[model samples]
Target: MHAERLYPILLLLGSNIFMTFAWYGHLKYKSSPLMIAIAVSWGIALFEYCLQVPANRLGSAVYSAPQLKGMQEVITLLVFAGFSAWYLGEPLKWNHWAGFGLIVVAAWLIFLD
Candidate 1:
């Protein structure tokens, strides 16, 4: 990938990580009130969109909308994998990796010319 493409992809990847945490990290904090968790999630999600939107816009010059969406999905899944292992203290087994690989293959198909 070109340097420009790499930056946007990195931005998207980072944004997805924030978004995944915002959306699902609350599961680990079950002791917190539902409303409180929702509020906190929304706060974090705002930051996610801040980066996500720019990443999409920058990537748009080099990729189509569907390609950008596919890239976002792939990055989201990758971020969720790391978040699961770290924040959720969950282990990723071979099957999980295989499933992710399949999803990446789908992303490639979506982005292919």
Candidate 2:
């Protein structure tokens, strides 16, 4: 694929890494004050948005909105699966894989002409 296509995927992947941490990394710090957790998450989310906005804008030049969203969903699932298992100590059950597979199928359909 061309750089135009690959660049957005790379940006989206980086953004999702930040997003997953912002959204769920706090589970490890549950003992912290709610305000503190929220503040840190917001700080991290700022970085996520910084990348996410540009990714969508650049990706839009080549991909439809639906395609971008489908890509984001798939990336999110893949990132979250790793994050949950490694950081959160949560093992994915069989059903989780099955559900993710179904979503992958949906993403494949979205990319089909």
Candidate 3:
């Protein structure tokens, strides 16, 4: 693929990393106060939005709105799968893999000419 498109994909991947951590990283710290979790998550999410906004703006040059969203969803799931297993020690069942496979197919369809 062209570098123009690749940049947005890379940016999206980075943003998703921050996003996954923000949303789920605190689960391990259940004893932490709710306010602390919320505050830290919000701080992390600030970085997510920083990259996400630029990713969408740059991606818009090469992709439609639906395509951009599809890319985001696909990246999110992939990132979450790794985060869930490694960070949370929660591996997905076969059914979850099957569901995510279908989503991958959907993203493929969305990107098709």
C-alpha TM-score for every candidate: 0.91, 0.97, 0.96
Which number leads on lDDT?
A: 2
- Residue-level lDDT tens digits of model 3 in 1-113: 99889999999999999999999999999999999999999999999999999999999999999999999999999999999999999999999999999998998899888
- Candidates, ranked, lDDT: 2, 3, 1
Winner by TM-score: 2
**Could you list the CA RMSD of all candidates, in the order they appear?**
1.4, 0.7, 0.8
Candidate 1 per-residue lDDT over residues 1-113, each given as its tens digit: 79778877988988998899899999999999999999999999999999999998898888888889889888888888888998899979999999999989988999767
- Model 2 bad stretches (over 4 Å): none
lDDT of 3 at 58: 94
lDDT of 1 at 59: 88
Runs in model 3 lying further than 4 Å from the true structure: none
Q: Rate the local accuracy (lDDT) of all candidates.
A: 0.89, 0.97, 0.96
Across residues 18-44, which tens digit of lDDT does each residue of candidate 2 receive?
Answer: 999999999998899999999999999
